[model samples]
Target: MGLYHFAKSLVYGLLKPVYRMEVIGTENFPKDGGVLLCSNHIDNLDPPMVGITAPRTIHFMAKEELFEVPVLGKILPNINAFPVKRGMSDREALRKGLKVLKEGNVLGLFPEGTRSKSGELGKGMAGAGFFALRSDAYVVPCAIIGPYKAFTKLKVVYGQPIDMGPIRERKASAEETTELIMAEIGKLIEVHR
Candidate 1:
């Protein structure tokens, strides 16, 4: 297997029993074509957790600072992660994300931009919406509900793909599309949490 799949398998083996992870609604995930997998971030472990559980390989946009770290810097790209300059409009990162989707790959995003310290859902960023609209990919909303304490139940719920047809038809603003995405994520959180 490739590095990404190998790492995913390793992580899954280790975390499944430790977190007692329960994943629901994975059926909602499309098996083919490009996908924009958007989720609410709560902890640093969120990205890997989501990646391993997802049926398809997910290329994540990690913060640029992470790439400066010692070993992790060299490892991130091998595992399908690329750096994005946070707290600014980084055009290069956006282009990279679009490229990933355009090639029929799953591009995972945390719409909140950063992990929430209080574990509360935060505002959705326009970048995710931009990707969704631009790529015309399946926009899948996901929620990771967790305290992450050892042996505790951590649930990852994948909600149905958001219907982007209307939004595309109306040529809605990215912010508006982001609102719809966040609303769907909120609903998933409500039902699962």
Candidate 2:
């Protein structure tokens, strides 16, 4: 098996015993083609949780600081994790994200840009929308309900793909598209709140 697949399998196995993980709306995922998985960021585990739970091998746009770590810098790239410089419009990271999608890979992103300290979904940044429009990939809204505690039930629900008509038609700005996508993510997780 490929490195990504092998790692995903190993992590999934570990998560199974640690959290009562439930994945919903699995059919909503595109069988192929570029896909942008937009999710809310609650904590650090959010990315890995979505990665292992999703139906496809998903890549992530992690913070650039993570890649600065000695060993992690070497390992992240091999596992499909790329660095994104937060707090600014990093063109290089955006380019990498577009490339991954163009190659028909799943690119996992959290529109919020950072984790919410209150566990409440906050305003989203424009990065997710930018990538969505640039790549013309399917935008899948995902909500993660738990893993707040070990051995606790955690639910992840994938909502229907967002219709990117406004984005496609250039009728909406990146900020506006981001708001719309974040709204969908919020709705998906409302049930668990």
Give me the candidate number with maximum lDDT.
Answer: 1
Q: Which stretches of candidate 2 lie over 4 Å from their true place?
A: none
Each model's total of backbone clashes:
0, 0
Q: Model 2 lDDT vs. the true structure?
A: 0.89
State every prediction's TM-score relative to the real structure: 0.98, 0.95
Q: List the residue pairs that clash in candidate 2.
A: none
lDDT of 1 by residue, 73-104 (tens): 99999999999998899999999999999999
Give per-residue CA lDDT, model 2, range 1-193, as digits (tens): 9888887888889878988888899899999999999999888888878988899988899999999899879989999999999999899999999999999999999899889998889999999878877777899999988646888888999998999976679667778888999999999988655
- Which runs in model 1 stand beyond 4 Å of their true positions? none
**Candidates' RMSD to native:** 0.7, 1.3
lDDT of residue 92 for candidate 1: 96
